[model samples]
Target: MNCPLQGERKGSVNRIMRELNGISVVVPFLNEEDGIRKFCNTIDKYAEKFDFFLELIFVDDGSTDSSVEILKQCAFQNIKQVKLVKFSKNFGSHAAIRAGLQYASYEISTWLGSDLQEPLELLELSYEKIREGYNAVYIEKKSIKVSKANRIFSRIYSWMMRKYAVESYSSGGISTIVFDAKVRKYLNENMEANSSIMLQAMDAGFKSTVLSMDFHERSAGVSKWTLSKKMKLFIDSFVAFSFAPIRLVSIVGVFIFCIGVVIGISTIVNKLINPNVPVGYSTLASITALGFGITNISLGIIAEYLWRTYDAARKRPVFIVSDVVTIKECESDTQ
Candidate 1:
């Protein structure tokens, strides 16, 4: 199908051929019906200026709303190539992005959210940098206009990732990223169910750089990411990428064992000093409870790791595509 915006300007064909290159923009969204149309329009506008052929891949993470329908409608309206991958159920934004990447046809693939908070102009800079030999270009948030509590939480999360998961974790937010085929291949091959894509990309040992940008407010729809989801992402990122949790359990176990020995020696010394002294039930109970709590926590952490190992071994597909609507099919139907 020919680009719909191609004939809008005089001598546009030559410009497209000379300045524009093909790029696949992978967008993962869940229940983003309010903003999907605006998001697509913004992408179209960017495509016009950059003169690049856009292969827009929208992965619908089982939106119960009209998101998939809106995507289909937009696909029919746009001249740029559009592909919709509808999930059977809500997998996750990361899973959706991974699914999109598998079907991407272009060498340069860019990831964007459906909320339209991130500026599309970053693509131009990212494209330029990638052309200059960078394997990946990441759009980093210089600052976000969020609640103070959220800001604090974000800082703590960032610190945890840097201290435990990966040192470059600060550069790994899922805002906007443009990567070449090499980076995409690396990610596809080393897929982890619970890991953050940005961290995975950072660990891929690619020549990458971050472009700092101001994060804008969402144009429409409330963020589907709840506190629980944020916490899950944090834990998943750490577990999938770092062995620090296991190390922490080991350290705590050793500390508890040493404390137990010290307490035993102290109790023996006290009993010898005062054989008639009554045993303090409260002290015995407190020590027993503490030991039990620590032991249970340690077991829980180990079980978490073991469960993830079993999940990986099962090799379940990260996402199941229930339906796909492509631009070519839409064009054919219209013709």
Candidate 2:
């Protein structure tokens, strides 16, 4: 896992090139059959621009379509190395990426979706930054070509992450990331369910750089990130990394207790001043309902955190690879 340029502090572009070995590109996909071939071809085309070897690790997150079949076919292409890791079931993209990182063989690793929304040139930029001694390089999307509603949701999610999780959370989402083997090891060792890789990397206290790029429309296939999935990811990230929800619950509890105390004191004073003051049943009922609602909400948030803790303690494999298809340089020539 040692970097090709070990112990080299800073060097010119020529020196960096001389010391670089290769990069591992992890592409995690789910039911992206229509775009798999095009994606692989695009990677091969752009890969030739660099002199270093490229290892393509395609993690299939239980794709129901022929995505795996197409990947098997692409394995025979004129690529340096291609490995397909098929999951037993749909464990989600984050899990797929984690699985890919575990199997990545090169010093540097990056991830991209099967849909060609991100330009391949970003990979080159990431590599250059890694060569410049940065442990992690995250791609931030300056703008997206999605619907207005999607845009707003993205913004809100980004804002929440920055405010709650970390100030440096990538607004562009964690779909793409480039980091060296050192950072990769850290991520794998400290993996958590429903967590944000970008946030974790930023919190790793490493020297990192963010490169802003415009997100393009998908070339083929509709996006698989449904609304439910997005919401789940949001909750998972917050529960895993932020204590804001728990703290909010505590604050609400304290505020409610203070309000109750004030109400009680006011009731006693009014009763003493006017013995005929009748107790209002409606007010009592409303207060009771509010208490119940807040209690339930607080319990729910606590339950979420407890469940995540239980999940992490169990230490289940994020993804189970059902199959593998690998194409080596020597094997490709015979085919």
Candidate 3:
């Protein structure tokens, strides 16, 4: 997709009134046909109350359903423009959101999920905070009404991230974020695949404000966030931002080596004291297995960093856009 306010030759550019008082919203979805119309209607009602305009950028991340068709058929009230980006295949939600950011035109931009779990009020509140000179506004959930297992995972992940990675990361973890054009442009230009965009934005040292809010339960469509994908995100967040894991490997290696030294000394002293004692194979086998296990884990952590480096070196595109559709508004209507 083309960047905002540039002459386009490589990809198409869908023009909007850049000077309009508005916020651009990027909604990324996968197989959310059941909620498209309802989401649009809800946003429309919310937008009707705003004095500023709204730009909705919907990115379809390779949904094998009627989502695109339903999206195309839907209409919005009080929205300045509607842009749809259809990916060739499932490129992941972060990739989809990044794709939408490339086309953002307003002074402020934020992303929301198609499930409508996050309230539109968060966007408005974020806008106010951004106007107060914060470059980014993070909506941290006061309470997440997800499953017990998911909530536990979220808490652990959030704590780990704050402890080892970004110190300023939200305690409850971040889901919805709103940033001004400056941060948005920075994120768009500096894109890294297999990385957490939220973490990336936070690590950039931009002035950010966090709001403690409650997120609603999903009103429609099942979530596409699988456990394996969450694990990948966890690994990616650490690998991309923190060296704690690599440092941890070193720490564990040193610790294990010290223990081995102590054990060896004890064994030698025991042998000298009791020459009749037999060297136990069970003890040796246990030590061997423990050493191998630690070694493999250390190697695995190192490999994560190396693989990300190799992937970045290859300069692969984070996402491939197969199609783009823009619903334009009349010049008079924009005014």
Candidate 4:
């Protein structure tokens, strides 16, 4: 079907106020129709507490439900500023996030999902810390009320993240974060709206500070991030940010080669000494191990960048403007 924004282009829309600076909260939402009021209220509360000129930019990311209308409902509050950019289709969170960052007319840019597991109170701390002297202030989850299995996996994930991605610091700790507009511009201009948009923020090459916090139960509709999606995010983060996984392939190859040499030497010694040691199992095992080793090496090297390149090559437009609610589009780009 043709997008709503395209239809709306011929109709009335939200009006933009005079642009303000300080902090812009970019919330990327899909089917968050039920939580818009609560989410906006929390943002209003935190904005007052922090005493910053705040604007809430909700990117609808092509929601196929009443979320756009719900966002429109909150637009009446106009607490400082409330803006929504409804995409023509589901360009996904990363695209919505990039749009918010680009549309953000502020000094610092931040994003929080509509799920509400991340609290508004932490934004106060993040804003304060960003002002103090850091390029970015990442909110690290100190505790989360997930299942025991999730907690264990989170630990292992964080450990692997620390070792490979950040090089020296720990990750998976950061759930929310705030960064200077300059750092955000780097990704907004260059990144594909594929996955793990946060990884781009982390890779911005700045002295980032971490603030430990806790994740609470959601305050609204169910999460869009399934276990499978989260697993893909974990893999994407590693593949997008570091090459340690591929390096492991090389390490495994060397270890197997060394082991094979030793086994061959031992087999010859045994044959010379008694010539009766069984060779069937050893030969079969060696062949299996060698095959596995080569397969892993090939997979790692081939995958190191193939998927990302494929996504880039597809060159999907980040967001389709079904219509404009606030900002006017240039004739060339829109036409």
Candidate 5:
């Protein structure tokens, strides 16, 4: 069923507009019919309070529902411009966001989630930081009130990202961000498959500011972030940004080789001491199984890197835009 825009504004606007700048917000969603209307309403509400010219770039990530239709029919009072980019098929949120950035018109561009987990006010905060001379602003979630599984995944992913991939990565992980045109241009040119866009942007070495915030739980449609996708993201992030996995494999190989040599010498000495001792097939079998298991895991890690290399060499387009719908409301404010 198609959801209509909320009759009353759902966003809270406590502070008045401090600056006037054209802001482009890229929203990537998949099957978010339940929340897209409210999401749009939130943007409109924010526009009412804050007079900054707003340009919403909503990227439809191949939703099987009426998310796009709802967006097309939705009306806004204060939003300056709206662009809906429809993808050929489901290409994942990261790719969808990249496409949206490519189409972004404003000098300052940022992305928001359809679930509304991040507050709309972060835009103002980020804009302030940008005006203060930062190239980008990362809204780092200090704590996320999600399920146990989600919490665990977030902790592990953030830890690995900080320890291995990007050392400057936030401890709680980053979901919301605002960046200027330089970073936006960089992202538009660097198209990476099966990679984290946020990681790429951060790894590019931009002058950035971090604003700590707490994440709200989902109050609408179910999340499309499946376990398989998360696992793939984990692998992609490491392979694309870090050499730790390859280094770990090499270290494990050396350690295993040394262990094997020590075990072989011990077995030879034991055999010389007791020539009639019964052969310990159980120990031999366990050792063989462990060795094979480790070797297979190492091979799998190497295969991931190889596959990404091949994928990059293929030079496939990161995303395909099947259609685009642009709507302009009155005259947009100049930056």
Candidate 6:
């Protein structure tokens, strides 16, 4: 309900900021004005279920709408435990979530969408798995409101991933998941800010499990992610997880080299068969042009691979955070 804000003073929740400890609920959003309330309500439900002080760290990822205002209102009213962190620009979902993770107060932090599509109940399931000794548990999308084309592309992309990029090959039938802070820290510690953590989690060699969950339609507003975005994510998934693209280029170069050797042997046999057959311009010109073109293509691929390595080495900023709200230390004392 439109709670007033006092110029964003570290989230003014009038509710008793309880002394209970453990668990941080991080929800990152971009233009989720209508869904924030319901999302907060879901957080309230989970808060009650857990009996631990729930620190709902909500990131407003450069929303032009009333989303930040809505979060400010919720924080002011203090229905439950929520802290608003507003970013200066839209850095996308992964960046927003990573920002939230950096400021997370509790040792056990989990993230989900602001739409509540990744069910709050998954947190409990994830926690249970963590208790059982898994480092990370990622949400496996069982079913989604995706189109047929998207599904096909996803299948093809995932297949390519298995064949070429990343590691820890596991797919299909997994959704909202949970794990310890160790896993989260591992990801934030050694990942590209713009890269997806899901792939890194797979490659980290951590014992992980994926729990299935019902994918619900967005409760409000439009999905920020589109097909193009998904395709980009698909590429990111491959680059993030596997070096197959680079490896594929390397393998192709080797194959081409072998083929060139065989062609050289064939030319010897051709000369032996007919010494006057190809001491001419036509064959020489064609072979020279073809060989030059293939060599250039192979060199170009190698250059691309080198550029990718340069990108990794630069350590450029993937995300810039404008604000953060985490668990207060008074709460940390209890933990």
| C-alpha lDDT of all candidate models, in order | 0.78, 0.80, 0.86, 0.70, 0.84, 0.65
Candidates 1 and 4, the one with greater lDDT: 1
| 210-327 per-residue lDDT for model 1 (tens digits) | 8988877888888887898888888888788899989999999999899989988989999999999888889889989999999899898899889989998999988899988774
What digit string (tens of lDDT, one per residue) describes model 2 on residues 2-38? 2343344543422453334778888899998899998
Sorted by TM-score (best first), the order is 3, 5, 2, 1, 4, 6
What TM-score does structure 6 among the candidates reach?
0.74
Q: Which residue pairs in candidate 2 have backbone atoms (N, alpha carbon, C) closer than 3 angstroms, thus clashing?
A: none
RMSD of 6: 6.2
lDDT of 3 at 290: 98
Off by over 4 Å in 5: 1-20, 329-335
Q: What's the lDDT for candidate 6? A: 0.65
Q: Which candidate would rank higher by lDDT, 4 or 5?
A: 5
The candidate with the higher TM-score, 4 or 6, is 4
Model 1's alpha-carbon lDDT is 0.78
TM-score, predicted candidate 1 vs. hidden true structure:
0.88
Please, what are the lDDT tens digits per residue for candidate 5 over residues 1-335? Answer: 11122232323110111123668899999999898898888778777776466778899999999998888888877786688999999999999899999877668899989888997788888888998999999999977768899889998999999999999899888996799888988988888998999999999999998999877777698999999999988999999999999999999999989988998898889999999987789988988998999999999999999999999999999999999987643342332
Best by lDDT: 3
Best by TM-score: 3
What's the best-to-worst order under lDDT? Answer: 3, 5, 2, 1, 4, 6
Our model 5 lands, by Cα RMSD against the true structure, at 7.1
Measured over all alpha carbons after superposition, the RMSD of each candidate to the real structure, in angstroms, is 5.3, 5.8, 3.7, 7.3, 7.1, 6.2
Off by over 4 Å in 6: 1-21, 75-80, 166-169, 173-177, 256-304, 325-335
lDDT of 3: 0.86
Of the two candidates 1 and 3, the one with more favorable TM-score, higher being better, is 3
